[model samples]
Target chain A: MRRSERLVAMTDYFKENPYTHISLPFFVKWFGAAKSSISEDLDIIDAMFEQLGIGRLQTSAGAAGGVRYIPDYDMELSKEKIDEIIELLEDPQRILPGGYVYMSDLLGDLKQLRIIGKMFGAAFKAYDVDYVVTVATKGIPLAYAVADVLRVPVVIIRRDPKVTEGSTVSINYVSGSSRKIQTMVLSKRSIKENSNVILLDDFMKAGGTIHGMVSLMNEFNATVKGIGVLAEAEDDEEDRRVDDYISLLKFQEVNEREGRIQVARGNYFE
Target chain B: MRRSERLVAMTDYFKENPYTHISLPFFVKWFGAAKSSISEDLDIIDAMFEQLGIGRLQTSAGAAGGVRYIPDYDMELSKEKIDEIIELLEDPQRILPGGYVYMSDLLGDLKQLRIIGKMFGAAFKAYDVDYVVTVATKGIPLAYAVADVLRVPVVIIRRDPKVTEGSTVSINYVSGSSRKIQTMVLSKRSIKENSNVILLDDFMKAGGTIHGMVSLMNEFNATVKGIGVLAEAEDDEEDRRVDDYISLLKFQEVNEREGRIQVARGNYFE
Candidate 1:
């Protein structure tokens, strides 16, 4: 293949696989091109990704290293995205009964999820996340979004044991929103030992679920990379677990007459 | 900016907003180059996307013409990805209650979702899809994945209405698994009239919920662009409303006692 053709193929491959490493020799063999040619092609693709701040192309020297695409996001881009999310949350249309925001739309929105994922990914990118973790139901989207950008797998801890998962490792954690003792379980095989995990959820109140995830990680001999929430209530300041976390938007207050929302500062977006 | 820098910038711009249009004048102004030079740059980018089969750079000529990048995936790539998913599902550990395979891992897997998104995007590339639609719960991830690659907004129909979403338009449909009445709803403002929608979900049993989406789309005067499911069971030889659809795997049967999974031919590795 020609240099132009090879460049395109490499980018496409990286985008689909994310967080994967590729050696120059593989491309050199696939394209019947010189090592120098593949190197030059990567230079172009790497520069493109870096300038965009959406992904990173890292070149490893020596024998084992070739090129690894690190999926990431720009802080400015993240800020703009979160600002839009906060605006959406504050919309009178989103307010629902019992003070819950009808967030199913935001959760279902691909664009909004992408922004949230990127924000979460950006926050945890530096921490070496192996899996994006979330408890059953609503947290699935948040976990999936982060996993997509990070190019890592996601581990879902179910609210109840289903026969489909066979044997599982269960953890009893307090619910952040409901403040009830809930049991979350993972199929023992779903997670690998010594993996780095980033915990995420759609909404966070007391963060008891996140603490459960932390404990689950401990059970698996894994590491807790970071924590992220799509919406965090600022009023419940006493129950948070880790200070090192990011929230795309903060739900400041809710009343019969008015509600307040604001985007929090984070590493993903300036 | 230099040609090299301009090339990098344009590529990055396209990647961040994967499937969107950019006028020639936009590039011409950004690069301080002639229309012809911009055309050449675009050609290079298009060829790269084509060679990789991961993106499309389309050009329109006329008073209102410009270029748009539509990210896409090849059928062969989709097939390979499906095979991988089946392999994972085959792990015996995934078998859950009610013949539902534990899909939390696959749903949470970012790299897999990206491939799934790009492939689904390719299938609907020719369709005039406006918003992605799905019922609440499992459909959330499907909507998120499709929305990511299609660069379109997603509207989620709730199984149960919550206070946050305000007033909703409800639909009653049959569910695949139970063949029972299920309710799905959409906020009045969520989907626009005359919009073109693509329906997606993670699993298809009887495909009753999809029918509800179709009805809801009708209420909005919108068109059904396409329908897609991540996995479909073979025993569902029932009435079909979807004219075009794709699935990664076709489950032949699940023998719980033997801990065996039977999967038949799927388009993904074909």
Candidate 2:
């Protein structure tokens, strides 16, 4: 293959497998290029990535060393994206009965999910997260999106156990809204012992769901590294069970009868 | 930026946004390059993609015309991956009580999901699938994965209604296993009327769950374009409620008492 062709293929591979290593020899074998030539190509790729602010190539110079793509998300771009989404959410039509925002639209957009996922990944990227955990339904997509960006497994806590999953570990915790005891379960084989986990959800109220996730993580001897949500109920921050978390938007005063909704960019910037 | 640098960045953008169009002017503005220069860069990228079999860069030549990245996956790589995973599933340790195969590992692995998602996307990419639909719990991740590849939204069917999702359309279908009546639902706004959707899942038994999803889609006035499953039980194929679906792997038998498991690549290759 020619130099430009090899570069395109290499760029695709590196973008797909971020924070992962690819030795010079593997590139040499895959592209049938010389080590020195591959090194020069890497320089070109790294420079482009640096200019784009999409990611960076961390190259180590030794036999055991290789190049890694570390996603270097632009905070300004993220803020703009989040601001745009927040504006979309502020519409009165988005406010449903009982103060619920129509979150499915945001959850259902691929472009939005990519930005939200990367934003979450950027916030908790420093931690050693073995699993991105969330409950079933709405939170599953958010959890998977974060996992996609972080390149980790997503452990979903189902509301009810299914026969297909085999043995599981179940727990009961208070719902943030209802304050009623709710049971969530994870398969016994889903997570490994002593793993680091990051909890992500679509929305947070009193944070009882997140608290339950923390308890569920303990069942497998896992530690909670961080907590992040796409949106948080700004009204009940004082009543939340979990602190030290991140959110992209703060939803407050969502009164359907009044046709009123307040949406602001979350603490992701702060 | 130079043509070479633009080629690399364009490749990354195309890979990230598959089956989406990028107008020439957007590239022109983003790169601060001339229209002719951007055109030349796209040509180089398209040539490279054509040679690599990763995807194709389709160019349109009019005012509304632009370039699109259509991923043309290599089947040999996909077959090898499917065969390799089949070997892993054949491991006796993956077999669980009542002949249930432990699937969380595959569902959890980011790399595996990428391959599986891409594999499913390749099969249904030609279809005009507006939404990738799946029932809650295990199928959520798979649905999101395929949606990622196809650049579409995922509509999840919840077993029960949540106020957070707003108003929902519900349907009842008989569970293929227990033959018990069960209900599944989707939010009214998640999918539009007459949308084309593909039903995706982690596993298929009597096809009852997928059957439930098809019925749920009907309530939205949406059409079920196709159905794809990661694995299907061969023993119950004749007993399935739905026909005309694709599966990547076949679960023939799982005798936990004797610790014997049988697995084969599904109809995906054929």
Please give, for residues A168-267, the per-residue lDDT of candidate 2 as tens digits: 8999998987879999988888888999989888888899999999988888999999999889889898888999899999987798888988988899
DockQ, all candidates in order:
0.46, 0.75
What CAPRI class is candidate 1? acceptable
lDDT of candidate 2 vs native? 0.86
Give the alpha carbon lDDT tens digit for every residue of A1-270 in model 1.
Answer: 765556556665676666778887888888899998888877887777777787778889999869888877887777777776766666664556676667766776666776777777777777877787877667877788788778778777877776656678998877776778888888887888899888888777777777787888899998886778777777776867656667766777766456533435432232
Note each model's CA RMSD in angstroms: 3.5, 1.5
For model 2, residues B167-208, the per-residue Cα lDDT tens digits are: 889989899988999999788888989999999988898999
- What lDDT tens digits, residue by residue, belong to model 1 across residues B1-270? 555556666765677676667788988887789999888878888887776666678889998999888878877766676777777778765666555677766766666676777777887888878888877566677777888778787777776775556777887877656678878777887877888889898877666767778887888888987888877777774665553577767888887677888775454444
TM-score, second chain, candidate 1: 0.91
Q: For model 2, what share of native contacts is present?
A: 0.78
Q: What is the TM-score of chain A in candidate 1?
A: 0.90
Candidate 2 clash figure, as a count = 0
User: Model 1's lDDT to the true fold?
Assistant: 0.74
Q: Interface-residue RMSD per candidate?
A: 3.3, 1.4
On the 0 to 100 scale, the lDDT of residue B205 in model 2 is 87
